[model samples]
Each structure stands twice: as C-alpha cells, then as structure tokens.
Target chain A: MLTPARLAQYVLPLMVLGSTQLMASTAVDQQIEQLRARVSAHSVEVNRFEQELLHPVDTRVAVFLTLAGRNGLEVDAVELFIDGQPVASHLYSKRERNALERGGVQQLFTGNLSNGGHEIKAVISVRTAKDQFIRRESVHRFTKSTGTHRLQLALDAHAPDYEPDVTITEWK
Target chain B: MTGLFHSWVSAPAIKIFLLIALFCDPAKATSPTVPEELSEGVVRFALATGDITAALPLQDRLKGDSADYLRGRLLLESGNVQQGLDTLVQVAQGRYHRGEAALMVARHYGAEGDADESRNWYQVAAKNGFGETRQKARFALAELQRHAGRLDAAGKTLAGMDEGYWTAVGYLNLATDFARTDLNPSRALVSLRVALAMCETDTNRERSKELKSRLLVRAGQLAYAHEDYDKAIGFLKKVSLDSYRTPQALYLHGLALSEQGNYRAAMQSWHRAKKYPLAYPGVEDAWLGMGRGYDLAGYLGQAGEAFLAASAAYEGERATLRELEKRIREAGAYKSLVDDARNADLEWFLADSRTLTQPRLAYLLGLIENPVTQRAVARVAELEEMIASLEQQERDLTVFMAALGNKPSSDTQGRSKQLSADQDALTNAVAALSGPNISPAQKRHIRELRDALNASGSVLERLSNVGGGNNQRQPRKRQAERLRKQTQSLLVEVRAVRDEAGKALDRLALEFIEQEDQRMAFALDKTEQQIAHLYEYLALKKLDGGKP
Candidate 1:
C-alpha cells in the first residue's frame, strides 16, 4: 500500500475529482447569472405595464352644440362652421325639435385639435309669425387647450327681430 | 141686326176696361218674378237638409257668385276635396265673395295638413274677408299655430278675436296646449275657465260641459300632485258622472280622500268608481290603495284580499321581475360551480362539453387545465403543509424548552468551566501552528495536535452543555425562539396561500357572474320586447274591434 504506484493511483483520482468540482462550480455560477438577468428583465416589463395602467392618453377635443330656447319662432335648419369651414348641417325634424325643446344637446364635432384659438359660427333659418323667413347668424370664439368646448345657440326672445345668440363655454 | 150692335158695344167696353187696368197698376201688370233673396233661401234650405241633389237644381237658379260658392261647398261636403278647392280658389279671386271663398280654401288646406298653405290662405282671408269669415279665418290660423308649437303666436292670434263659440274653442285649445305642452297648469285653468264662461250657445253647451269635466279632472290631478287633497277632492267632485272620464275622476277623488285620512269616504268613492261601465286607468292603484287602507284599519283579512287583487292586476310585471330574479339565482349557482371547477383536481367533473357550455365554466376549466395553475395550486398546498408541519415542530420545541429550568446545577457548572479552559488551550495551539516561523515538520505535528484538540473540544463542549443545566436552558431557549420565528414565517406563508385561494375563487366567480349577467340582460331585454309587442298587438286588436 505504501508503494509509489499505489500512491499515484490514489493521488490521480483526487486531482480529477478536484478539477471536476471546479468545472461544476463555474457552470452553476453562469446559470445563476442567467437567472438574475431574466428576473431583472421581467421586473422591467412589470413596471412598464403598471405605468401604462396608471395613466391613459387623452388627446382629442370635443365640441358640442345645444339649442337653448326657441322664442315662438319655427327653426327649420341650423348649420355649424368651425374655423371658417363647414362642419355640420342639421335640418330639424319634428322629433328633433321636440328633443331640443326638452333640453337635449347635440354633438356638433369631435376630433383632435392642437392647442389654439378657434371660431364657431352657426347659421339658423327661422320662420316668423308674419310668415317671413329670416336667417340669423351668430359667431363665438373659444380657445381649446384641452377637454371639450360647448356652444349654445339660443333664439333670443328679448331681441326685437328674433336674433340668435351664441355663447361659448369650456368644460372644466 | 140687334146682335151685331150689342157685340160692337161689348168690344168697346172691354177695350176701355183693359186700358184702365194696365194704366192703374203698371208695376204688377208684368209676369210675377221671384226675388233673389227667396231664390237664395231655397238653395240654403236644400243644402241644410243635406239633399245635394235637390240643392243642385236650386243652385243653378241662384244668381252671381253665391251659386258657384254653394256648388263648391256641396263638392267639399261630398268629399270631392280637390275639385272643391279648385272651385273655391276660383271664387276666392273674385272680390264679391273673396272672404268666404278664401276662408273655405284655408280650411281645406288645414284639413290636408299643409299648415304653410293654410296659414297663407288664412292670412289672406283675415286681411280681406268680412264679418264672421274674417274672424273664423283668424281663429283657424291661431289653431294651426298652436298645433305647430308656436304657442306665443297662437296666443297673440287668439287675443285679437272677440267672444263667441269659435273664441271659446280657441281658448279651450290654448288651455290644452298650456297644460300638456307648456306645463303651465295655472294658465291652462284660467283659459279653461274663460272658455267655460263663454259657453252660452245651445249647440256648444254639451261640448262645453264635457270640456269642463275634463278640465275638472285635470285640475284635480294637478291639485293632487301639489298635495292639496281637499282642493283636489273638490275639483274631482265637480266632474260630471256621465263623462267618459268619470271613473278616473272618481278614482282620483278616492285617492284625495285617502290622503285626507277619510278612509270610509275613500272606500265609498272607489266602490262607486268600480260600478262605472268604463274601465278606470288607475284601477289597480285604487285596489292597492284599498289594501293599504285596510291594513291601516287593522282589517287583516280584507287587506289580504285587496292585496291579492292588486297582485293579480300587476301579475305581468311581477312575473317578469320574478323571472329576472330567478335568472340571477341560477347565475349564482353557476358561479359556485365555476368556482369549484377552478381547481385542477376537479377537471374530471368538468370534462363533459355540456358542463363547459357556460362561458365562465369554460374559462375556469381552461385555467384549471393549464399546467401553470396546477403548479401554482400544488406549490401553495405544499407551502401550507410545510407551514403546518413547522407549526407542529415549533409547538413541540416550546414544550421541551418550558421543561428546562433557568439555572445550571453545581456539577454541570464545574464541568462547563473545565471545557472552557480546554477550548482556550486548543485555540492557542492552532494560532501558534499558523505562524510564519513554524517548520514544516513542526507544523505537521502541530496540525495533528490541533485536529485532535479540535475533535476533543467539540465533544467536550457538547458534554459540558448537556451536563450544565443553566447553559442547556439557554441553548433550548434559543432553539425555541428560532422555532418560533420559523413558525411565524410559516404562518405568513399559510395566510398568503389562503389569500391567493380566496382571490382565485373571487376571480372565477366574477367571470362566471359577468357571463351570467349578460345572458340575463339579453333574456330580460327579450322579455321586455315581448311585453311591448304584446301591448302593441292588444292595442291593434282593440282598434280592430277585438277585446284588448
């Protein structure tokens, strides 16, 4: 058992065992590094999803038109123009007139608009008691920075000749 | 010779008499002629009797535009409206009868629903027509304006008219418009009272009475809405018993009486109302009111009977609501099933396609069949079991530590001091062997000695701790504290697993309920549509003379 050949046999196996352990440790370390990287990537995705859920994008301006009141005048048609371009035309039917009488508002235009000033014009055609057809135009200017802009077109009862009044308001 | 002389004398005498008669009454000497007024009266008599054939021959004998106007009227009354309108327009162009003709034309246009044309003709007639025609045309224009919802203009037009039957009709219309369209009950009542006061003509007396009854009912309802029960009852009592609205008025009267706590009077009024041939619109409400009254009066049997009648009347709507409630209950049951099916171990129960027909059940089955869900559930269960085992271990350790006392015995204390001295000696020897100046042979010998000393030190420390009762208590206390900490951590894990299980169950239930809610909504919508269609069919059948 004390011979050099027998001693070589024992020492050689020991050396091989030590080398095998070193290789296994290196592979294990690489695997741990890969796992850490994957965990970091998954954490980033989760944070991004949470950020998106917390805040949503709102980028459009909505414009609404409403008939405030009719002063004993039969309104036949109404046309709306935004920034000198015709956007909507509505011919009031009997049912629509009833709705307007009940204080229902109509959406005139809804689209994306940059932060700036805009002008809205409404042309209304009404029949007077004397059987005379008259066209009354009212214009309002508003600044749309965000949210919605509302315009009310009312038949002015106090006006001498049944003129239309237009007012602009912004949604807070 | 004598006869010839007598004939000559008679001829002279006859000639002298004829000359005197012609000279004395020249006005009556010509053939008798009929007066134009008498001819017009004959044509009017035929028209009034609705004998157009007789009026046709008489109309030809009439002079000037009256004949043409009468022909146009006959044509209109006979339903040749377009032809009559043409004839009236022709007459309207003439100055003699333009007023009447224009009024007729406006009325024709009004009946045809051409308000613009009617208004135009009415304006012409009002400006150029004479007497009653001008007044009637103005009233017609006002009526057209009222129907067109130009209430202010209609009021202005009516304001210019004087008191008469047409004016009364105009006021009645204005009252109805104010009440129904403008929601001005006070103004409507004023107009209606004005119309009632103006009803002096025999022809309009019955109509006015009917309108008065309607007004009384409306006023009573308005007073009821305002909670003026005495005024409501007073107004309702003024409603005529013969009016079609009598039953409804009596029902309202009963309600007003009930509001005043006059239960006997209310019941009497309701009984009277039930005897009416016409059906009351609020009959069911009357029954319900009776039930409430009986309940308040402590008449339990009567109250039950009244309530049963009310329920019968409301059977359709109650059935619909109950059906919807039943659907919700079924959905709850299905949600429970979906919750149970969320467990992967219950997959065998959900294997049938029929069980998966429900969207929520299918979704739960999908999750249960997923390997991730199975693994997650298994991991949670494992953690829970581990926590339970750790808790048991901690409990055992706590008992063991409690059995140990706080202090060590005297014999154990002496052995603990000896082990401490031996440990210090070995630590010094190991430090000396690790010095830089030590030889290899000496280092090898010291290392052997260090190994032997270390082995003995470990055994000595264990033996000393076992024998030293006070030191053994410290280690046991520390072990117990460690087990407690482990048990606490395990409890947190178990709680987390329970929370996860609860959340899973909630999510599955929510999914199942959402699907069931959509199905219920669709079913309810379909039921509502069927109810609406049934009501429409009943209305149509009523129009067709069938029972509603």
Candidate 2:
C-alpha cells in the first residue's frame, strides 16, 4: 500500500503547502511590523502637537517704565495711572529710595495697552528738607501704534523752594 | 581743528590753486560725497529728549513716509495736535507705517474724548497692524466699549483675545465693572475665577490672590444677602485661609451654617473665626454668630453669655443692635446663672477637644475628595498591562526563533569545500605531469586531464552555487516548512491580541474624553443651579425685610 509514487504524491503536496504557508506567515509578520512602526510614528506626532498646543509663542505688547531720578527730594511713594485708572501704586521702601537717590532706574510697570492715544499720570509724594510732605503730579500723552513704548519719569528740583518738578517722557 | 584746516587750505595762493584743481577734476568739484544721513538717529534722539525743535530740521532732511510720520509726531509732541494728525493722516494714506500713523491719529482723537473716531481708527490699526500692535488695538476697542457701558459688547470683545496676563486683567476689570453695577454677580464671580486660574507669574500671583480672596468674600456676601445659605457657605469656604478676608469669610460661613440649622457646625466656624486677632473688624460679627448658633440650638443660657461678651466687645458701636440686646435678655431669663456658667464651660471644653473635620461645602468638594474618575484610570491600567504582556510575548518569540537553528548556508558551504578539494587534487596532478623531462605527448595528455578536472570542478561549483533563488529558497523552504505552522499560529494569536488591545485602547480614550466632557458639563450645570437659587433667595429676602 505504501508504494514510492503514492508516498511522493502525499509528500510533495504537503511540502508545497508548508512552503506557501511559511511565505504567507512571513509576509504577515512583515506587515505587522510595518503597521506598528506607523502607529509609533503617529503617536509621536500627536504628542508633539499636544505639546505645541500647551505652550504657544508669546505675542503681546511690552511696556517698559523706568523712574529716571529723584532730584533733591526724598520721594516717599510713586503711583502710576493710565487713562485716569490707577495701574500701579508703590510706597517706596528704604532700599528703593536709596537706589533712586543714587540715580538708579526703577522699572515702574510693564504691561499691555491698546493701540491708540493713552495718557500716563505719575503722582510723586516726597518729603521736603523741613519734613513737610508734598505730592507732585505729571501727565504724559503718547500714541502706541506699533513697537515698544519706554517711559521715564524724572524729578527736577526747583532751586529756591526745592520743589519736586515731576516730568514724564516717552522714549523712542 | 576746523581753524587749522581752514588756515592750511584757504590761503590766497592755495585757494587759487585748489580752485584750478577742482575745475580740472569736475567729478570731485561737483559731488562732495554726500554726507551720510544721520537724520533718522538724530530725529529719534531728539524725540526721546523731548526736543521738538531739534527734530524739526532732521525731520525735514528725511525723505519718504517715515519723514512725514516723524514730522507729525514732532508736531503732536509740540502741542500742535491738529497739525500733527493732518500730517500723520497723509502718511497713513501711504503703504509704509500706515498702521502706526493710523494708530497715532486714533490716539489723538481718543485724547480729545472722541470715542467714535478713536474706535474707528483702532479698528483700522487692528486690521492692518502686525503682532502686538494688532492685539493692543483690539484690546483698546474693547476698553472703549466697556467705557461706553456696553457690557455685553465688551465681554464679547474680550472673549476674542488670546489667553495672556493682559487678557486676564481685562477679564478682572470687566468683572469689577459688573460687580459695581450689580447686574450679573455670577458673571463677575466666573471672571474672577478665570483670572485666578490664568495668573501664572510671580509678579501677578500676589495681586491675583488678593483679588480672588476679595471677590470670593464679595460673592459670599452677595449670596448671604440673597439668603442662599448653602451657596454663601460654598463661596465663603473657598476664600484662602491666609488672606486678610479670612475672618470675615469665616463669620459669613458661620452665619450661613446657622441659617441652615447646623448650629453645632456654625458654632465651630464662629469659634475658629474668633481665634484670629481680636482687633479685626469681624470679631464682633463672629461673637454674634456664635450667640445666634447657640440660640438656634436651644442652648439659651450659653447664647445669652455669648451675646453679653459680644456686647462688651462692641460697647460704643451698633455692632450689638437693640434687637440683639433684647434677644440676649430673653435668653438670660430662660436659664439660671449657675446652669449658664456650667453649659458655657462645657461648650468651651467640647470645642477645644474637637478634631479637625472634613469641610461640609458642596457636591464639588465631594467630587474633589475622590478625583480618580475611576473608569479612565482602570482602562489605562489595563492598557499598560496588555502592553507589558505583548512585550513579554515578543521576547519569548525571539528566543524560540533563535533556538530553531535554521542555518540554511551549511549545505552550500560543505559543497564549496568539496569542490575546492577536487580542484587542489587536479592542480597537483597537473604539476607532476608538466615536468620539463616529460614527453610532449605526455604533457598534452596531462593538460587535457587537467582541463577536464578544472571544467568538471567549475561546472560542479556553478551547479552547487547557482543563483540565490533555488539555493537560498530550498534551504529557506525547508526551514520555513519546519517553522511555518507553529510560528504562524503564534503570530496570528499575538496579532489578534494586539489588535484587540489597540481597539480597547481607542475605546478607552474616547470614553475618557466623553467622561471629561460630562464632568465639565455637570460642574457648569451645578454652578448655574446655584446661581439660580441665589436669585430666588434674593426675591424671598426682599420679601423678608432684606436682612443680611
């Protein structure tokens, strides 16, 4: 019953079937590997996009304010107002007063403002040589159409009275 | 230096000779290499120094739209506002610096209190300007709307702004305006909350914290005025403990609790509020709240004692009203002095021994207490386990494949070695036959034999090696045949599991998103309900003599 031809018939077909199955399996494995790689790449891209969404580039107006100097007056406090609304008011600490007295510039306020004409009002409270307290106010009008606006406030001393001459100027 | 140069170059004879030389060199005579233009820098320096006169000459020397703009700025700075605006408008008509010029014109109008004109120009600049300029213009337009009392329009304008510190401030300002008008207290509360969330910088932290605490107290007060005791408590409890508003917040919290009939809890809140510095404004309120709590709980004698203490604390002030004094007298009549002293001592002892307890705030607090959002966490854990399992399966598969020992090159290598041995034998035989002493015929025979051996070896090697197709495929076919069934079945199972896990992960991700959406919606709904209850309570409070 187990003749050579009969055996060849059974063995050959089985061998062919086995070879085809092996090739098909190998092809399937390669496909799975390729798909996994694609999924990995896509996941990485999604994570990158999420990160971008979380932290975006900064594109906002920057206003730089500096108190230029206090001339012969012991400035006790400075208050800044924009369009009649107070934006910043600080009572000068002893260290800050000393820094201003030595011609050091103090950054008063940095914030965003709309493009148009804006008025800056500075109120300076100073102690006179006689220990009298006096407040001086100055206003500056400027246009913020483009770029940065740098504002400086300086106190000019009047000779005889030593009155605080407060001036606010916008630097280009 | 100028005088010395003049003396050397302008002597009579030298002048005559120089004139002759200039005439001979016509290019040099006509063109005195035009001095480098320093007008732009000069104009900027003059502007910075507030020197309009100095800028005027430099501006005149400048050409193009920038010159016109600079001249306009100079005129504006010099107090000639109309002239400056006219000049700037001309520059705006040009393409260069159009946004800047338009913005300047807008500012001039704004300064004059012409809001309509200012808004129009701001719109132009917002459309034409780039980066921060555009943002500023938009913000200015919104500010104008707010100033014009168009609250809704101002809110809409602010909504379009990008999330930033200024936008937060804008929201805060709008919230302040809303609260001042007393139109939509809930909107103000929401805006203040958003501002608190957006405050990220150290510089803004203190301000935002203070603002948030103040707003929280204000909102609590508003709720209390409306008689929405629960919402009042909720809002008051959120006020930061470290804030100066804490004393007032705690007093309000106790009042809300007492209104809700949680007299013991109200007493606790009041007791805690009293622990703060006694000089605080809320101290009298705290004592009064404690007395009310005791009175509501039917501890009339202890209530009388608390009221008496409060009266002593606010002797000269109306903090202890006539009605409150009458209530205290009535409570004193209900119990004997010894019993009142014993009850008071017992209350103090109990209050002192009490442990810190969970805040009875709101459903939101309940949600915060257990914030896992369970299903999402479970799904994530499952996905992590599946990934780990798959990794282990992959490692096992690698080990199995390595152990299979499917070295298909071994057969070809053996054949190659056999062919080399035969070729060496043929070479040695030829060497022996090719000696000089051998006959020509013998040499010919040896050559023929050598050629036959070499040809056979070449043919054998060619047949053995051939193209990589059959030789490579035959062994691979054998190896594949040996591995195909087992490896394929395992791979199919692995892939099927992987695909199932992937699908599950996707489902989980979608479910997570939906859950988050639902949670947010629920929170919003709860807030809206609370606000509506407040409105209803306000109506009832108005009917009940409007006592807060």
Candidate 3:
C-alpha cells in the first residue's frame, strides 16, 4: 500500500504549505517580541524623563513604608498627610500586606517639597491576632534641604507592648 | 575617577550610559553601600518597582550570585543587550544560576540570528538545566537545526528531551522539515507516526488531541493524493468523529473507498460527513459526493432524494454566507476580530477552532485562522498600545508642567546665576591653561577638563536657549514642555499608524469572508450541475424503459 516515490511527488505541495505555515508563525512571534521590546524601552524613557525633569533632586522627597517585625500586626489601611494636606493613602490587600511582612518596602508617595520645615503625619489602622482593631497616628517634623530626602516609616509591633511603634528614619 | 570618566567621553553611547548611571538621581550617588542585613529588603524594593534604571546603583553595593544575576537581568531590561549577554556569560560560568544564564544566552543568540552560537549555548543549557528549562532548550535547539535544514541533527537533538508537548511538537516539525526538504514520503510518514505516538503521551491533553487530528488528516490526504487507497483509509479511519478535522477526513476517506470500487462504504462515509455542519471543511463536497455515490450504485430514487437534500443544504449555506458577508461590511464583525487579535498565545492559529465554532463565526473560520490575518490583527493591537503609551507620557508631562509653574521664583533665579557663573569660570580656566607656560602633562589634563566642560556647557546651552530661561529652573520647565510637545507629536503619528492598521485588518477580514463566500458559491454551482446530471440520466432510462 506504500509507494514512496510516487507519494513524494503527490505530497510535495502539502509539505511546502506546512513549512510556510511554520515560518509564518515564527515571523509573527518575532514581530510580537520586537514590539514588546520597543514598548519596554519607550516606558523606560518616559520614566527617565519623569525622574530627571519633573521631580528634580533639589526638591524631591520620597516616603517609603516598611514593616519591621514579625509580630501579629496586620495593617488594614494607612493614610499619609504632608503639612496637614492629604497626599497618599492605601488600603492594604492581603497580597500587599504579605509582601510588606516579607521585608518588601513600598514607596508610598513621592513629591516635591520646598526647602523648609514640613510636618508628616501617618494614620495607620491595624488588626491584632486576637481580632482587636487599633488605630495609631505618628507625626514627625523634618526640614527639607536642597537635596533629595528619602524617609522610611518602620512599623514594629513587639510582643511586650504590641503597640505600633512607628519610627521615621531618613535614608539620606 | 574624573579622568577615567573623561576618557570614556570619546564614546558617546558609553558617555550617555555613564551619565544616566551617575547623575540620573543624586540620591543614589550620595548613598553609602547598603548594609548586608538591609540588602534583601533593598532587593525586594527593586523587584517590586520593576525599574531597571532605579535599581542600577543598588547593584554596585549588593554582592554575591543573586546580585550578579540581577545585574545581568537589569542590563537586559535597560536595553543594553550586549552588556547583558556578557554579564550573563559570566553568571553562566558561576556555580549558581548557570543553567538559567545559559538559557538566556541561548535565547539572545537565537534572536540575534547567530545560529551556531545559539546551538552551542542551547546545548550548554540542556546540560546544566533541570526540568522545564532543559526541555525548552532542547526543543529550541531542535527547531534551530530544523530551520537550518539539518533534519537529521534536529531529530537527534530531540531524541530524549521529555515526553510532553514540546517533544511532540519537535517531532511534528521535524516531520514537516523532512517532507519539505528531503521530499521523502517514507521518512515523513515514519516521523508522523512517531509524532502521533508522542502526542498520546503529551501532558497538554487538549492541544495534543487537536494536533493529533490535524496530523491524521494530513497523513491521510498525502496517501490518498498518491492513489494509496488502503493507507489513506487506514489513516483517515482513526480520526475521532468529534475532531475539528472530522469532515475533511471523512470526505477523503470516502474518496479513497470509492476509488477502490466500494460504493456502499463510500456512501456511508459521505453520509457521516453530511451529519456535520455544512460550514465545516469538506461537508458541502461530501453532500455532493453522497448524491453521486447513490447514482453510481443504481439507486435512482434514493439518488434523486440525495440530490434534493444536497441542493437544499447548499442553498441554506449560501444564504448564511451572504448574511455573514453583509455583516462584515457593516463592521458588526470588527469587535470579534479585535478581541481575537489580542490572543498572545503562540499556538493561537492551531487553537482557533475553539473560538471559530461559534454559530455567528463558524463560516468565517478559514479566513480568521489564516496566519496573515492574525498577524495583521496583532499588529493593530500593538499599534493601539503604542498610542496609549504615548498619550500616557503626554499626561505625565502635563502634570510636571503644572508643578513647574508653582516653583519659587527666587530658587529659579539663584540656579540660573549659579550655572552662568560656573560656565564663565570654566571658560576662563580653559583660556588661562592655553598659555605656553603650561607643562605638557598639565596641558593635556587641562585639555581633557576643557573637553568635559565643553560637553556639559553644550547641554546647558541647549537647556538655556530652548527655554529662553536665564536661570536653571527655566531649563527644567522648558525640558518638560519640550517632552510634552514631542509626546504629542508621537501620539499623532502613532494614532495615524493605528488607524491605518485597523483599516488594513478590516480589509483583510472582509477579503477572507468574500473569498469563502465565493468558494461556497462555486461548490453550490457544482452540486447543481451534479444534480442535473442525475436527473438527465434518470429521464433517459425512463424513456428507454430499460432498468424499470
């Protein structure tokens, strides 16, 4: 039932079609990859523009949030105020809370602050292991200099007190 | 440090890269090395941000294998591909992440069209990697060899790479390569049989089933085309009834049977094919074939009835196709096309049967599943994304401009005077150093400083002249305004390109639908012609008073 020589003559077109289809698929794949790379590169350019021009180093201030301890303090929400003006606020999703617990630092807010004394207030809501809800407020006053200032809010809940100890430290 | 950087200034690309690294953010430049205890936290932060430029300085402070791996990744992310490949090669030489690094290097070389290097790196990845990575490398290596027309090598490379989808696909591709290049049907059939066996063991159940059906139909068609009735029948008979290729396989099987003088078996195959939707491949042809089979078997009454059924089905199919063509023209089908176009799956063409089976879209499956149409549709989606990104950049610039307006005037004036004073001082230093009293080494040092200063001065001039700002703040504001303008122009260009791409997709879709409609029309004409032949034969027999 098998005739190799004659069958080869008959099936040549089909083989050509199959190879063309495969090559077309590969070409499409390459085009999509190139497009993805171009988009990524464009995004980086936009980010550079934002960082260098829009938010100049002389007046830029970044606020970062970090969880310092493994105590049973589950952050529900955190709201930030600068000079009594509402600036940044976020309600923690389970995933975000887990990331914070695993030593991930979140940049809560970044904006320009003129060279002068400014007041920052952080209102944090937390849930204890016993299902008790507690709200705590921490205020810190720091003078913004003519250079970039990065502030980190370290929230630690130790066993003895389990009070939300908010320590505000500047990176530079 | 200044002299080293100054020497690099001769190369503009390196200078620009170094400038971004050194001056993009003053905070990074001033910060001390990250503490060992804090490195993990910093790494997490960098990963969370997903910004290569932002995390670059951290790479300098972080040590060990993970940091090197991240540095390689960051270089790639930053679009410094050559540097990234070099870094990855170093990482591949290390004990940790060697397999992963080698995999990356292989992929990079593959994309760069360095086939030999790509093959070498793929072998290295296959040797060092475990599980998925090793399988992927082997599959890619096989693909590269096949593309290079080295069928035997491709097959050997795929010999023992896992028993899953990739391995099965490799064999299938190898079979195709053999057929196209060697034109050896025997070898191709052997490879196809192996591919089918591999398909049965593939973990991806749905994909394997789909691929198996397609392979069976292809093999059957090849045999049938060569007049090998028994082989064709054997292959076609194995296709599952519910498979996407069922109608095509049945039609081909009937043809093979009829050629073998088995009219009853042929009619049965055609009847089974008719039970499928008329929109399916070969169903219309099968309907006509059924009528002819009955006529040839001397069942006149049954043949007449079969002709009537075939005519009715063709008329209905014609009506449905006309309605679909009308809808395509009215853009009612545009949304569906766009939705399907966004499918990023690599095997989308092979899997399109699932989507095209919808009642409204079934008849258009041939056109929609076409690779050219899919490519056009995907291009349209990509263009839309580009336009969206440009618009987002414009919005960011708008916000930045608003902030610029609120900046204090005193700060602006002070910075402007400082830059101007610095520029004047640098110019005076260069002039003073040009005197003959200077030592040769000192003269060369002065020349280097002058060149670096000249470079900085030109940048300052661009900022000052464009903004018409006598001060530093104006330059920043002008820069934002300039970017906003550039973004707006790019948006216009991208939007125009997207419009053209969208129109092209519409054209391709409509063209496909019209072509399918034309095909059905031709089939209907042939069915009518066959019916007329049966009617005439019956009339001649009745008039002669022969068989009756």
**Best candidate (score: lDDT):** 3
Q: Clash number for every model?
A: 1, 1, 1
Winner on TM-score between 2 and 3 is 3
If scored against the real structure, what TM-score would every candidate get?
0.36, 0.31, 0.53
Candidate 2 C-alpha lDDT tens digits along B1-548: 00111122233333222212211222222221111143554455445543233234344566754678777887665445567789888877787777888888876676455777878888888778775566566667777777778989978987887654445555666777887887546777777667556544314354456556666776687778768788889888888775546777888888888888888988888898876643333545686677667656766557667766655544422332333234324432112211232244333324431111211111111212222222222223333333443344344334323422333256655766787787888788677766669888887878767766664554455444543434433442344333434434444554564554444334433343344334434433443443354457557877898752
DockQ of each: 0.01, 0.01, 0.09
Give the per-residue lDDT of model 3 (tens digit) for B474-510: 5656877877777776666666666666677778877
TM-score of 2: 0.31
Q: What is the TM-score of chain A alone in each candidate?
A: 0.56, 0.60, 0.77
Off by over 4 Å in 2: A1-172, B1-113, B121-140, B146-149, B169-203, B218-234, B241-248, B263-287, B298-548
Off by over 4 Å in 3: A1-42, A45-172, B1-124, B127-129, B144-151, B176-190, B219-280, B289-336, B340-356, B359-378, B395-483, B493-518, B545-548
> Chain B vs. true chain B: TM-score for each candidate?
0.46, 0.35, 0.59
Identify the superior model by DockQ, candidate 2 or candidate 3. 3
Alpha-carbon shift of residue B96 in model 2 (angstroms): 9.6
TM-score of predicted model 3? 0.53
DockQ of 2: 0.01
